[model samples]
Target chain A: MPLDLPNPTDLAVPGFIVLMLAEMIYGRMSGRAVYEGKDTLTSLLMGTGSVVAGLIPAGLGYGAAYYIWSEWRLFDLGHAWWVFVVAFVLDDLAYYWVHRFGHRMRWMWAAHVIHHSSQHYNLSTALRQTWTGKLTPGFIFALPLAFLGFEPAIIAFVSGINLIYQFWIHTEAIDRMPRWFEAVMNTPSHHRVHHATNPDYLDANYAGVFIIWDKMFGTFIPEDKANNPCRYGLVHDLGTFNPLRVAVHEWVGIVRDMWHAKGLKNKLMFLIGPPGWTPDGSRMTSDMIKEDWKRRQAVKEAAPANIAAE
Target chain B: MSLLQLLGSVIAVFIVAAIARWLFPVRFRLEDAHLHRELERVYPDLEPEEILIDRAGNAALLRLSGARGIVVVRRLGDKAVLRHWMPGTKVTATRTPTGLMLDTDDFTEPKIVLDLDAEGVSRTESWLALLAAPDGHAHAA
Candidate 1:
């Protein structure tokens, strides 16, 4: 039987709209959950572009996925309840690494950075996705599942479901879920750290559905609003609200850096290195920023003691 | 996605944006306490000794107590962009009829136009003098 599955994200569209409006209304009344008109518009338009981008027939997305399943699957693991359970969990693990790479590696960050370009964290911001995500080949992470015999349709369906689960976690409306739920699942608080530009929060929390993956992989950092209130958006925030510029800004950065870079090795490093990598170390990468943060923290801690000593 | 869904996404995009504009309509105005909190992450625990806010309250210049150069800040749509002036940094300033025209080599934030009155202009020139060395280079070497 030919595999046919309705995209879960498509079905979730109406719910997405309803939830976004609810959040907006709550923001209005409570004076929290703020959203700027232009930021929200840019986010929504980016979401729309992503949906359109996926429509363009690409061998990389479902095409190559289905091919791997048909020709080279190690086992014909027939559709079972257990198969879907496995696919969902496994796909999320792949998502974790893909997301991690999206931050650490500039080539992938070029596409993934669009989603984080917004300064506001709201449901609409969840829709702020990458127009070129498909081109970056994150799906390669899912290829192992196809080879292990899960159907591409099944993977796509579960992937959509995983995405839908993530949409609710994008808002600042919710502080924390129940302790048990927070322990196992990705929540609003955890996702906030992922979106934050705080030095300590950089490159943390790359979970999809289950927060366990981040914990297992040692990438988890619990949200601490007291010490580090989440500052949304990139480390170097974009100056323009234009959606086109927001989408392709990192790619443009890469092109310019590579063009001026002296050696072929240095130019190659520009593509694979961290987001702010520079030959002369003019720009600070996440690690450098974190080191500086630690140094500053030590200084502050020592100041009180030194005063007492004095 | 269906044609109607496509249309819905488009309409809802604008509608949500419109609702956001209606709900929380406050444009961020730069303030000392607010800038202090925002720049804490960038400058650590250091505090600004002198500060100048533009007439429009969208940009600011600050001179730190022990630091040599002024920090330049310009408000984007929803956030403030901070740049530390250094001796070798590419930057220039020109006086305009209404205020000051500032240019920098930063790719994302290349140009900023600050509208100021006479007193504001005088303070700005002082800040510029503090930021620039005697040889016309930034003082924060």
Candidate 2:
């Protein structure tokens, strides 16, 4: 059944622009937000490229999703107000898992890394959408929703709202929200940690709309900016402003690693292993990096204690 | 995505980026103190002995204090990244007519070119010698 719903993301475009302009003005006066011309341009172009990619190649994802929904659905969950609510919650849960995989699995990270390529976090940084997300298996998480008989059109609409909700959380302007809000929702504070490269903050806070998902799982890390400041970007920061490079650099990395890898097993691991995986452990994954920091902290603390005992 | 929408988005990209550039005119300049702070932030507890900056002050090499390697800092745009080039890491530091160029065995930063003058070139000669030895590891205090 063709639902006559307009894409909510499309309608929100003007709001995104206006909010960005407002944020820029606020950043100018308050010094809370950071903006660089080249960074903003790169991010916006990525967003535009994402739209284009969705229109052209993303048909495969949309097609597959609806196929499962129409033919394989358990029940014909017709349009209802409550269906939207159920779709929103279930889709968010799916997002949590998919997003977790996006960070953990190398194949998915190739598609997702564009959003994290920026060294600075602000409203513009939120505009850095993935260009090749349709190619990856990230959409598989949403397929269950389709199977559960939620219309793909409805899923599409709510998922758009999920994304829209996330945009405002990309700023540094707002500190902590109200204590109640902070506990329940993913605020700018929580999302900042998600973007940070700081060892302690890496591979954490993968929430779309609700911070509770992260808390329910073990992925939540509170924003501790006092002790350790957030340094945004990937482990190996891309030092280029070219949106093309930003979009496909990780995909290139995966191919390069696979070609150089020794055995077929190792090559497969290069694709499936966590980002920064190596056979000899020459490179540090996020987990390894975090462990290194913990080890360093222990050594530093132990040194003083040893001296005091002596 | 309509043709009109796509064209409008392209135009908006320029307008937004321009507005950002206008508001934040000056990117973070790499002064010695600022560079020191940034290096410390990236590499916690790794103290640098000397900060060797180029004439342009765009790029710098921090000779680690009582350590086995140098930390390289290069500007991306307004932001700079601090990467460690430790001993046993194959960093081919050679002097060219242009400047002292380093072929770093790093995925992100494959090559590093340090713009240098005559005096700068002469000073980097020692760095070339230190990094080029068969051992290729300089243990300094």
Candidate 3:
């Protein structure tokens, strides 16, 4: 047989649609709104673009992995069930780092910001993806799995599986899963915290398949419903619904900042720094935003008691 | 996938998407409690319970009891910009054939227009009355 190299995501397209419809139905029956027309269309368009834009880069990434496996692999870990399992775990770990870096680093964030542009979180929001991730160095994160002697094909397969597992978590239909399952796996609740832009929920729960990574890394934050209902989207909102603008808005922001920057150091910092970081102390990072919110909240909390004492 | 298969997948995806849109629709739910909670968070001193929120939460309009100023919270993506309309704030709340137009001092371009129903118009009138008052927090409406 000719070396069958088919994208696994292609096979999952039908299933994705079915689950989206199911989620919409469940949401309606449960009296929680899950879908918006323009938002859904925008998300779908982003996904379509991401997949198409990803083609050449995906080939390059796979080729690099294959080259390493063939010429420079550390071990000849042959095609065994355990090897596949190991590859799966390693691929997931790679995904976690790629995702984290996508958030932290400005260049990666320019691509990743498209995913976070949607205000409403739903099945379609899962479809909201980055058209420019291919241009970024994100694929380098997965090269380790291939270098560890797993075939590039196997790595690609497991990566697809990882993505499919993550798809269901991008939803509001299913609340908290079983306590044990929620503790172990990345549930919808955990993912909701990841998607939330609220002060408490910002930059927490960056897990792909396992919640263990977030917990181990100390980035885990539980969903708090009583105090703060999860507000989805970026801190500074993208005021436009145009899909093209949504895709390139952050990239444009990065360019603008770099162009206005005084020196080479500042221009480079604009590319490598965090999303909200500026050369000057004007803009706030997620850390700064969270700290400011905490201080304000503390003041607000103490005000009534202080007044009473007075 | 072949060209035919690709076309088929596209058609199927759109079909499903269309169904989802039809089922859910895009109507912003302006819950009284939710609005009150949000308002209190922003303006802690203002009476959240006494505040009136329009049912059409598209362009959320608010009027506090005995307060001359109106609060218009515009939803942009996930983040909302809460525009405070004090007595001194150069903001005009006019009723158009389509809905209510809020021309404010903050944003000059792409004016704030809300597709208010009859109830929303009445509520806007009640809130705008506060802006017409000479003294702040003295108006009943």
The candidate that wins on lDDT is 2
* Model 3 / residue A62 / CA error / Å: 2.9
DockQ, model 1, C-alpha based: 0.57
lDDT of each prediction vs. the true structure?
0.86, 0.86, 0.76
Docking class of 3: incorrect
Q: After superposition, how far is residue A61 of candidate 2 from its true place, in Å?
A: 2.6
Candidate 3 residue-wise lDDT, A1-310, digit = tens: 1134567787888898888888888888896657766677778878877766756456677678788888899998877889879888888888888899988999999999888888788988988988887778888998888788888888888887888898889887777899999898999899989999887777888889988999999999999767777878777665456778888888877888899999999999989888899977777898887897898889989999999999
Which is the leading candidate under TM-score?
A: 2
Model 1 spans with C-alpha error above 4 angstroms: B45-50, B63-70, B91-97, B100-107, B118-141
- Better model by DockQ: candidate 2 vs candidate 3: 2
Model 3 lDDT on a 0 to 1 scale:
0.76
Candidate 1, clashing residue pairs?
none
DockQ of each: 0.57, 0.57, 0.22
Residue-wise lDDT of candidate 3 within B3-118, one digit each (tens)? 57657766775676678668866555555666667665555555532444444565676665556477766654333545556766666777788778878534211356777778
Per-structure clash totals for the candidates: 0, 0, 0
Candidate 1 C-alpha lDDT tens digits along A117-174: 8888999999999998876868788889999999989998899999999999999989
Give the winner by lDDT: 2 or 3: 2
